[model samples]
Target: MSTAPETATHFRPVPVGLLRGRRPAVPGPAVPAGTGVEVRHPTRLNAMALDPSKIVGTAAADDGEPRGSGHPAGELFVVCDLFRTARVEIVPGSDEVTTTGHCSRPVLARHAASVMRELLGITDGLLVHTEGVDLPPHVGLGSSSATMASVAVAINELYGRPVEARRLIRFLVDNHGEEIDGRSDSLMPVQCIGGSAAAGLIPGSVQVVAGNAVPLLSAGLPADYRIVLAMPADPTEWDAQQSLQEEARHFDDFLRTGRRHAPDIAYRLIHQAWPALLEGEVREFGKLVFDYRFRMGSIKNCSFSHPRLLEFADAIEPAFTNGAADVLGLSSVGPLFFAVTRTEQKVTELFRDAGLRTFAARPWSEGYSVVKSW
Candidate 1:
């Protein structure tokens, strides 16, 4: 496979407005006989919505209703890490969609089918094997959306499409609207494709995704910034589709009451931390990091729900004491906490002191890449 096209052009800022209608479909570019392509999508740490108030009704809706009330407006920051990622391999000419890889699951297969039907309009056979990292469901690392984004990029490459990572993210958000509710589809392009961006709606639309990459005030993180992920040893992965769907429904109910929590989200992210990131003021940004952990979790009704998670969050305070970490927060919901440190090695030792599973990572700068094609 040839290298992935530079995504800067793909991620360029689109005009702020509701894009009308689905894009027209065209036949995928032909590939040489027996060609196989592999593509990679990174994982994310947190997705901080700037104006939490506008999160629900911002992106253009796919159902043909006016995208939203035409008033909601804000951005979201997709904090990404390359420590764990989804790598998907695509082999064409199969009779049906066949998948293999630790990240490969039934839902993933279904999503691939849906992508094929909706994006390529092809019912042809394709074998897709996902590799790298076991993405436990709802881990808050944007794994599900990253998986979809990875496969989407792979398929795009197969068709020789030069779609932007951001556009693919929006495309997935628009097409798989309902499937991504309560999930972080907006952040997928940020993680799998690289760069931390502030994505939001222009008005009259709702992004309606947990991981879809949205428009950003800025992309990428400051140089020399470091991150450490403290995940539970037993993720106790949820395998039940019904239970997950129930969670999604409850999440929708929670969003209906966004007024209750959106303000805090806005203050911490948009008013405070967003500037801290831009100005390279880690300490000021660190304070918002502490506040957001509690506030964002409360909105999810799971703040401080896990003893190990709390214990880790508490024990790592010594990091601030020792001049190692400048900021600390939980990633998404529960059981995955992160620290912004001067050095990854120092944070790793601190996690050791707390007896937690940990990995050293940094903010990813690049998005998806094609490693091989044969």
Candidate 2:
């Protein structure tokens, strides 16, 4: 459970190519027929749980209808080392697209085909395969976003990289509707751009401006720090539509009754947590994040819905207070808890003893990679 050997902080410029921009007039060079591409995209952990009220510039449009691409408020997230792989092969003369593995549903396959047809004007049959960690869906790991982004990246590559990662993200967000119900705010941009690691903005924060993820800080977390994830073995099956409805209610409630702790949460993030992370003060940063969660009344209410989850959280709270873990909090909606800890083994064991599935991951700064192409 001791700290791992210090690794050099990986720093690189955020890929401007992924920033919002107009699509190219002409596409990149076309690949040979039957071209194939495989991409590895990282999933993310919400360092600070999302609170709808805090989201800026993302209310109903002038027409009183929700915008197609919602703007996400400033939020911090870490791209974990866990990955989902997407392999796509273009099969000429075939009339249909087929998908297998993680997102193998017929509806999902049709969705993939629709994306390809719209983006690249390709009607060729696509043989798509995706795989990732055994984590349950809707556990705040950004699984759906990762899968969609990976497939999009692979398709883009097969077509000779004509589309920028940012445009792909924008397209995904704008087009997200009944096809995919549970979409994470800003997760597509993070995954498409290879996350904060690939963007070279580890331990930093981002806000979605006009559907683009703009980095608020470029600092990196201490390389030795680890993220310990505990996913419940039998998590409550969260319906995407139902969850969205709940969030909508929370947003409406926030608009009707403003959050009194908004300013405090913002101050802590911008002043305390940001500085702590910049100075490589892991414990201080973690404490600030853990504290930030409580300030958001919406998140607290959501957490209370799952009694067992609350019980588990109560059991693990002592680790953070006792200095064994730096940060301890839930990720997104529910049923998954993470700790920023030096003693990952101890934290992992604690979660497992509590009857949860546990795994320890390091913060990954780099984005997805095209591991293979043909």
Candidate 3:
């Protein structure tokens, strides 16, 4: 059993510049309209399943009503320093959107077209090009969300900054069905707002309500903390064969029979883990993160469906036990597992020794920003 702190000596004051209750103003491009706009959106790690019930309910109806039942549940996430870049430009032609580079997925092209028609009401053809980090898709890095966010921000910029970040977030969340393929969590508000560099720690927990990402707690990790990621180069057969509809069915199964742990998960996130993060208690936060992963009903089912993921989790368990890392867990339904540590190189080497591909990323402090406009 643990007791609350008796004194203020142990915790640092929240950084004044890091407070983030309100939405940050979206920055505008200096370049004139119709110029090519490029924006970078950061990737994220779903640190814990705050509410498994909300995962399937993220899709909105044609009338913009959220499609699921139950009270909205929050999620714990970390914005990784990795980013996907998107550039959008208007072209002379009929009303269609085409994508090039790593973002050639038809779903993304359709999303761009929808955003354009819905927001600016332009019918002109547009070109969207994206550059991705060296990681593959569907490995739990939030790559698709980042790419879509980048494209959405670029489209907004290309049309003279008509949408604010919050409205843009709602639009994206409302139309997620057009982009997402399988059953997965809703488009996190963090994916659209990006991490605020000025917010220091970023929003450690958030709940998606009516397509808005409502921040529950905002805090940062200790200055010395780092995250090391290891992703298996190949996905399991179950992961590979899973279609959007199949994934949705999985969510349905969880809602029906697997959500018994939601209460425990919520308590840990709200009362335990969140406070630990605020006080810069990395080890405590990490322990909660590690435990929270298994507490997620969907992720527990995933461990059985994708047993290879468990093998990877097993391979890295010694690092936490030995204290080389402070935090350890899978990122989303993953081929990717992350260890939070002060010893980045050591943990990264451990993953490599286990025959996994690895990278080290800091907690990104800033959200998406316009990188170039011309």
Candidate 4:
């Protein structure tokens, strides 16, 4: 049995400048307002899952501030960057709600419309266009949440900014899940919601403390760190013909295990991982990250066990030996693997040598900055 440390009661914010890597410059001409608004949200890797009951919850969705749930809960995630982006464009005053994009998913567009209708209580004529780095549809990496977050930010911008940053995160958690469909698709999409959702929607590295109110803080890591994603070129798909009952059973079992194991999971995430990340202890941080992934993998139906992933891990083993990269682990519900490294060059070379598609991303510091406003 492992000893647990004191639970985190409050969030400690990190200085943005101290975080490693430059946020990639967003592209495209500035929005002139009347035409439309374009927004970019980053993809995330779940480092750990915090017990839900520990997260401070809002009395109601609209109240906005987080308060304790006063009961034990399960199903919250601690996330980091993969750096792939989901970009959305909203052109309001259309004839009806229309969504068009190269990489947009039907469920995502559906949720975006639903959120708009629920938030505004009306959706007569709104149009949303989304497209982004072609993220593998269902191998985790918080694609669903990222899509929803991109659309949410764009919609929030269209509506004259009624939802504040913190409140916006609550919106993404409203639903989350997935197997071949995605990670968050298994739950309410809440499990996939993390610092990436907050960062992309609001624009900063948000550390969500799952307690009474689910407190979120803007935290940063040292500038010397780097995140590299080893994404598989092709993703396998689940048969749509598979019985719904089987799927239900799979999810049910997964949830039950998470609940039963919540305490241990929560302790590692809040007590161990949090401090390592905060203080910039790279190897220790990586070890805790490995521990988190290992623990999650042990859960039935939750394992990301794949031969290709292991092969990739083996291929990148030398980086650890030479101290180019400090740690490596699976990215949330992934076929996408990640490595925490000392430099960007090491990450690039390793992936290039393996011939796997790679993406480089830094922790976002600004929660949500309007790139262009009319």
Candidate 5:
């Protein structure tokens, strides 16, 4: 019904050692009478953690067989702020992904309204309104993707449409997967939604999900811990699909060659990352994440990192041997680096005093879910 706020300033970064709870609910406009449904509890998107089985499913294109980790990746997760997930809801087995779903959540209602006011091509005076806590702005994480998938499911249910996973992924990909210079929003949600989200660069399959592993949960961390990110340089801009294609080629080659197999590693790590994160072996998880990103980058003759960022990564690697830190990488990409460490005030202060910013992330197994409809 109305435009989303111009900026997402309501979200606040966590304090160095605390799981900074989300900001107080910054309320938005009330849903106008019969305007549209509302969705809630969205999260940022996560990087794809590949599964070898899902990667090589028969449903995939025959161009070449994909390699899966036998399991999948991109499972363990966290949330910043999620306000709405909406739009299309195709019937299951209806094969509507390519045709039925809506892209651009947090903005859809406004888009619907604009169509009513200006386009007038097929208007019945339907106004879709979206409002909620502004999400954390970008650094490459999957905020928009989560928002879309959640809203798609919610609104689809509201309209009595049931979406199949495969089609839903495709719809999100089609609208969002554009060139950086063009219109795509990284289509980050495609893969973020399914076991392996829609990878525009890499081919995907809709057959039964591949892999034979189950995600395990833990009661709690051995001790309190915190995640710290180090931004060494400014973030960079690049085309996602092109980069993904290049990464996929390397992975394809790895599947082809038993020698130094990256595809297999990516697949294995996808499943492994879940337990590792649950068990709090987050330090190794970080390095594994870095290694995975690097190996994929090597396929394209690009390092998986910014030079300065790598330095920071190395600076923390030794801690792994001593069990000082777990997990590492640019929080989003290129310049920002992250490490998981037991909740030590000193560790937090280390990043803070060094003039780097940091925040806290809890283990989030919950991805995006539909909280309500109608």
Candidate 6:
């Protein structure tokens, strides 16, 4: 079949990381008087599911550390995709958790710490993670979200500021300085907003555009179908992320203004195209899929990509008889590409044959959580 690495679960790594062994669950930190305790939530690929290329921000949430003349107590935990999370230990004073693994854990941890510092309005002090998510790195998945969401769940518990799932997600949306540290909606919102009875009725369609980095995946995609996230083993860099922001400015205006820019308007139209796919409008939908991929192709990032995005389109462009692939896009600066194909067996075979790694997962519920609070 394939000659990829044997170590390559070549499948899902985030959740698998934890299966090998279990570390002691960490507890909440001690707090001072009158400080509001903070609790954290679980992590997911919420944003990526909507528009893989759009969810890139370099900010952390307020969960990892103490903040805003508030409570000193905080806690952290691992959420799902479920796996090897580094020993989640907290460094008080500074609000940040470290998720060290085989890949960019330490580096990501340090970056996450910085984001947490900013989000919580931390002035000088910093938070450090002695513990981390014990998982393989570089595989396309939401590891950063795991750490950040875990921190959020922990902080929420510590502060005693227990918010409803909607409220919790909204809090992150409003105050999230960046989506870089697992702030994407795929993690938490998928539970409340996905197949669950959270985001009202599932909309007719949910199309996320990578027009610019970090627009609104949950806001765009409808809740009808379960999410399928497929990632590879690479990521994007800082400069590319910035470029997405620039591209986003115009697209954001289009959404607000009800305007269209031919090429730019293509992906948005793809949103309109999805319902037709669900309703078995395969051929009609293929036209739109072609357009959407073309629109996204204008943008580029090193880590994440459609790889043979165009090639796939070419192969499947004419095969619209059986509810063909309705939508396909990259997960933010990714090598992690995703597609909503009607035929799983057929599509999976195609992907595997293409030498692309694949994983079979639906949207995860229970966004970032506090597994252990002492």
Question: Could you tell me the lDDT of residue 280 within candidate 2?
Answer: 76
Q: Which candidate is the best by lDDT?
A: 3
TM-score for each predicted model, relative to the true structure: 0.68, 0.75, 0.74, 0.67, 0.50, 0.46
Tens-digit per-residue lDDT, 185-228, candidate 6:
21111111111111111121332322211222232322232333
Clashes of each: 30, 6, 8, 36, 34, 70
User: Which candidate order results from sorting by lDDT in descending order?
Assistant: 3, 2, 4, 1, 5, 6
Off by over 4 Å in 6: 1-104, 110-146, 162-290, 295-309, 312-322
- Report lDDT per candidate: 0.49, 0.55, 0.56, 0.49, 0.36, 0.33
Model 1, range 124-236, lDDT digits (tens) per residue? 56666665465466656655545555666666676666555556555544433112223322211111211111121111111112223445444445677788877767664
Task: Please give the distance, in angstroms, between residue 177's alpha carbon in candidate 5 and its true position after superposition.
Answer: 1.2
Candidate 5: residue 222 Cα off by (Å): 7.3
Instruction: Write the residue-wise lDDT of candidate 5 on 1-374 in tens digits.
Output: 21112111121121111111111121221122222444553333232233321332222121242211122322322233223444332233432122123334424233222211221122233333333433232444544444434444444434333344444444333222222334321222112223222211112111112223222222233345555544433444444444444334333433332234446655555566546655655554555655554444421222343434444555544444455565444432334444556744555565565545555544333334445433
Whichever of 5 and 6 has more lDDT, that candidate is 5
Ranking of predictions according to TM-score: 2, 3, 1, 4, 5, 6
TM-score of 5: 0.50
Writing each residue's lDDT as its tens digit, candidate 3 over 193-269 gives 22221112223322212214444455666677788998776755332223333344455544542267677766766
Q: Which tens-of-lDDT digit does each residue in 204-231 have in candidate 4?
A: 3435435322345435656666677776
Query: Which residue pairs does candidate 3 place in steric collision?
Result: 181-244, 182-244, 195-366, 195-367, 196-365, 197-365, 197-366, 201-220
Candidate 1 vs candidate 3: the lDDT winner is 3
Residue runs of model 4 more than 4 Å from their true location after superposition: 1-35, 51-95, 101-103, 176-196, 209-217, 238-262, 295-307, 310-323, 347-356
Compare candidates 3 and 6 on TM-score and give the better one.
3
